[model samples]
Target: MKTLLEAHNLSKLYGNGRSQVVALKDVSISLFPGECLALMGPSGSGKSTLLSILGLIIRPTSGCVLVQGKPVEEDERSRARLRNEFFGYIHQEFAVIENETVEKNVMIPLQYARIKPSRQERQSRILQLLKQLNLDWAVHKNVSFLSGGERQRVAIARAIINHPSVILADEPTAALDRKSAEEIMGFVLSMRDQGCSVLIATHDERIAKTCDRVLHLVDGRLL
Candidate 1:
């Protein structure tokens, strides 16, 4: 099968000279449709950096990212368009707008969506997704008022609202209890089973074991 996303000889660096930090080095990987891949590494080992590059949130200092075999341009507008069209990135920090209502947070992606939906249609989709995630009751509530698990679920709902082809999750379960983590993974696995390419950056062995394949990183290099 064709690869959904590919990172070729990717590397990222921050700062200069004595203050330089290597976030990733000569790392290359691929994600295939309908597959779940886990990226395991210690903190600051570049997993999040790799995910950010792949998701088009940041550009690698060297190397390139490709989607469906075509190199992605580094232009901000182009990158933004690609991210909205093909990727759903779940940040480690939940990245939800704390002051925004759950419905509004999930509606953010749709605002930039290629084919903008009617207001009624957008609300309908949001309501349906919140219900599926068992978060319908909190639809109008501010995200700051929800529990960690609920916040995470809101993040998940927001991420998948665009029906992205690739899902990049950075430390998705890091802050959740075991049961809540499992619940989050259940949703991720469900997406993979339905043909989304899922890449998760995690320290949890059990979560890594559930993926179809696993890659380890150390000191910014793939091992």
Candidate 2:
């Protein structure tokens, strides 16, 4: 029951003076390994903003973030290394390179990590992930040619290529139909079972029911 990630008094503010807005207000959350947490709320509820902070895509205005019980430093060099080594993020947008082939898109993270797998090994891993997400048939297709769901699956593959300790997902199933959404939720559940903590920012009621815990966020704080 060790914690995988923790946020203490985390907050984010945008703009300044009269136009300043508080995106997150001293929100705190702790996630343990093997747990799937659904961060649920209506629009402008700060779910995505919270996810971005958790994934290290953005820094909190104040407070501390810890991964695996270790405090994170504010140094840019350290943050970048930690993000590359310990976390996976599936953003709301597919974020895949439209000009690249699906395989290449998925392999981009691995290459960035300087993981020199054999061509066969890389292809095998990509195929396995594609199969898991029901997108193996699009393995060789150009990213631009695939539908949104397919692109999202590719993005998921890319995020998970490193087998990260934590996965942060923002509206991961927004582009999928009901059946596909369920399939994706099941995949996330399996990740939790494997001891990789999963944090999802989603408004999908159906998907929320699949998580071990549902945190309701209102305005900028957990409700």
Top-scoring candidate (TM-score): 1
Q: Which ten residues in a row have the lowest lDDT in candidate 1?
A: 187-196
In the range 38-88, model 1's lDDT, one tens digit per residue, is: 999999899989999999998999999989999998678989998987998
Clash-forming residue pairs, model 2: none
Q: Indicate the TM-score of model 1.
A: 0.98
lDDT of 2: 0.86
Question: What's the TM for model 2?
Answer: 0.93
Every candidate's CA RMSD: 0.8, 1.6
Give the alpha-carbon lDDT of every model: 0.93, 0.86
* Candidate 2, superposed: residue stretches over 4 Å from native: 114-120
lDDT of 1 at 108: 95
Question: Where does candidate 1 stray beyond 4 Å?
Answer: none
Cα deviation of 109, candidate 2, in Å: 1.2
